[model samples]
Target: MAGFLTTHVLDTARGCPAQGLTIALYRIEGGERRHLRTLVTNDDGRTDEQILPASEFRIGDYELVFQAGDYLRATGQAGDAPLFIDEVPIRFGMNEATHYHVPLLLSPYGYSTYRGS
Candidate 1:
C-alpha cells in the first residue's frame, strides 16, 4: 500500500479557513533541517496538491512552518512587534504506510495541530 501527506489550516480568530497562509515542508535528517518547498493555503485553507503524494511518500521527520504573523497581517491584523505567535513549526514523524493528515487550528496568540483524516 501507499500513503501520502496533507494538511489544513483554520483561522481561529476569524472562525474560517486560513486563506493565503504560507507554509513550508522541510525534511529533517541528522539533526539538520533541509529546505524542501513552500506552499500557500488556498481558499479552503489547504494546499492545492498533497504535500507528499503516495508516489513520493517516505518514512521520515518533517516540519511545516506556518507564517502566523504574515497571515494575520495580510488578513487585516493591525499593529506589529511582539507578536505572540510568529512562525509556528509543527514537527511530526511518519512511518506507517497510510495517509498522514495534519491539520492546524490557529490564532494570533496560539495554535494547535492533530492527526486528521
Candidate 2:
C-alpha cells in the first residue's frame, strides 16, 4: 500500500477542536525546505483530505507548521503582543509505506504531538 500523511489540532486551553487554524506542509531536503501545501482546519480540527496523499508520498523529512498566533488571538487566548508560543512546527521522517497521523494538542502556552493511528 502507498503511504500518506494527515494532521489535526486541538485547543487544549479551551478543551475543543481548533477550527479555522492554518497549517502548512513542507518537504525538507539537504538544508532547504520546499513548500508542499497549505490547509485550514475544519470544524473538527482536521483537514478535509490528507495533507500529503499517497500519490505524492515519499520517504523523507517533512514539517508541519501550525499558524497558532492568529488563531490564538482570534480565539481570545493570546494576552498581548509577542505572545508566547505562536507557530508550532513538528518535524518527522517517513521511512515506510503506510499511514501516518500527526496530531497536535495545543494550548495558549504549549503544545504536544504524537503518531496516531
| Per-model C-alpha RMSD | 1.1, 0.6
Give per-residue CA lDDT, model 2, range 18-112, as digits (tens).
99999999999997999999999999999999999999999999999999998999899999889898899999999999999999999988999
TM-score of structure candidate 2: 0.98
| TM-score of model number 1 | 0.94
| Sliding window of 10 residues with minimal summed lDDT for model 2 | 80-89
lDDT of 1 by residue, 29-68 (tens): 9999997878899999999999878887789999989898
The global Cα lDDT (0 to 1) of model 1 is 0.89
Model 2: residues with Cα > 4 Å off, grouped in runs: none
Off by over 4 Å in 1: none
TM-scores of all predicted structures: 0.94, 0.98
lDDT of prediction 2: 0.95
**What lDDT would each prediction earn against the true structure?**
0.89, 0.95
* Residue 29 lDDT (model 1): 96
